[model samples]
Target: MSANTEGFKTFWEQLTPERVAHIGEYYTDDAYFRDPFNEVRGLPAIRKIFDHMFVQLHEPRFTILEVVHQGDTAFFVWDFTFRMKSYKPEVVQTIHGSSHVRFASDGRVSYHRDYWDAANELYAKLPVIGALMRWLAKKMA
Candidate 1:
């Protein structure tokens, strides 16, 4: 672990839809953020993604499982847990993923790219598509 790695962990743990305003504290003004669904640049544009996350999901939270830091870069694996608003049984969903982040000299991330299995983590968990995804996985395997 590096000096600021703990702080970075804290920042991630405390991040929430209502607390997204603090993104600037952890990301540069011209930071680039990307995930499986969105690839965007700048702090304001990135904030919109976080804003939309809250709008679309209920009680979304991230649990940091591990952090690997080397030089000015770090990789954090996390489990994003949330509940689907459309589900009748209100099951809690979890997606295991990792983020590769490059930190600036000031300790703010300059670039963030997320890596995850979309088919297994998202589409395969769906009600209708899940069935098809399972069949496809069997065929491919």
Candidate 2:
């Protein structure tokens, strides 16, 4: 792996609420980020997403499973694990997902997009929403 990729991996695996403030070090000032729930641009907006994650969940963390790099683009398969601060705070929830990132010339992320099945990975783990989501999925299938 390249130095940039290695640094990025280390950064994510060790991220914490306090580290959210330094997100700009890894992303360009005008970077773009998108996931199932949010799509935003710029460093401040990206910081808010990380901040919100810490606020809404307990011990939110990313475990990188695999990484592929080619030129300025990289893909990472990761598992995000956390406990919901609301309903069942004791239950640990894990979301399997992948991220596609493009690096800028300065070795910072210029664009990032995450892929994950929110319906099955997230909503299906919720209380009433989980039952409804599973039933609807079954009906559709």
Candidate 3:
């Protein structure tokens, strides 16, 4: 593993719920997180974002597939899986995604960006949107 890859492993291991409250230990105060759907800033806001995410998905977990780091920046390719609470016990949907993260001097993420197909992974799981999204996914695929 590369230095950055090791750092990323350490970083992810430290991302438990309790550690989220003390986000300053891992991320700069003014860090930014960007994704296809949302952009969030600051540790406090970021904390809230994570909190909401934890509650939104059931058993949300990341499986790291690849990692590479240079200087203080580490990039991780991962797959995320979880169930939407709205689906309850009836359905278990999985979402596949990847992230690009940059760590600061203190080993906290300065920028976090995620890339994924919400339409194929998420919207396709919905009852109404699922039909249209699945149709679109089939066409695109």
Best by TM-score: 2
Ranking of all predicted structures according to lDDT, beginning with the best and ending with the worst:
2, 1, 3
Off by over 4 Å in 3: 1-7, 11-14, 137-141
For model 1, where is the 10-residue window of minimal lDDT? 82-91
Ten contiguous residues minimizing lDDT sum, candidate 3: 7-16
Is candidate 2 or 3 superior in TM-score? 2
On residues 1-141, what C-alpha lDDT tens digit does candidate 1 reach at each position? 986677778877777876798889888999999999999999999999998888778888889999999999999999999887767428889999999999999988899999999999989988799999999889999
TM-score of 3: 0.82
TM-score of 1: 0.93
TM-scores of the candidates in the order shown: 0.93, 0.98, 0.82
Model 2 C-alpha lDDT per residue in residues 1-141, reported as the tens digit of each score:
888898889899999988889998899999999999999999999999999999999999999999999999999999999999996999999999999999999999999999999998999888899999989989999
The regions of model 1 sitting more than 4 angstroms off are: none
Candidate 2: what lDDT? 0.94
The C-alpha RMSD of each candidate to the native structure, in angstroms, is: 1.4, 0.7, 2.5
Q: Each model's number of backbone clashes?
A: 0, 0, 1
Q: lDDT tens digits, residues 1-141, model 3?
A: 655457556656446677667767667899998877779898888888877877787766677777766776667777776677767545666666677788776667799888888877777667888998778868989
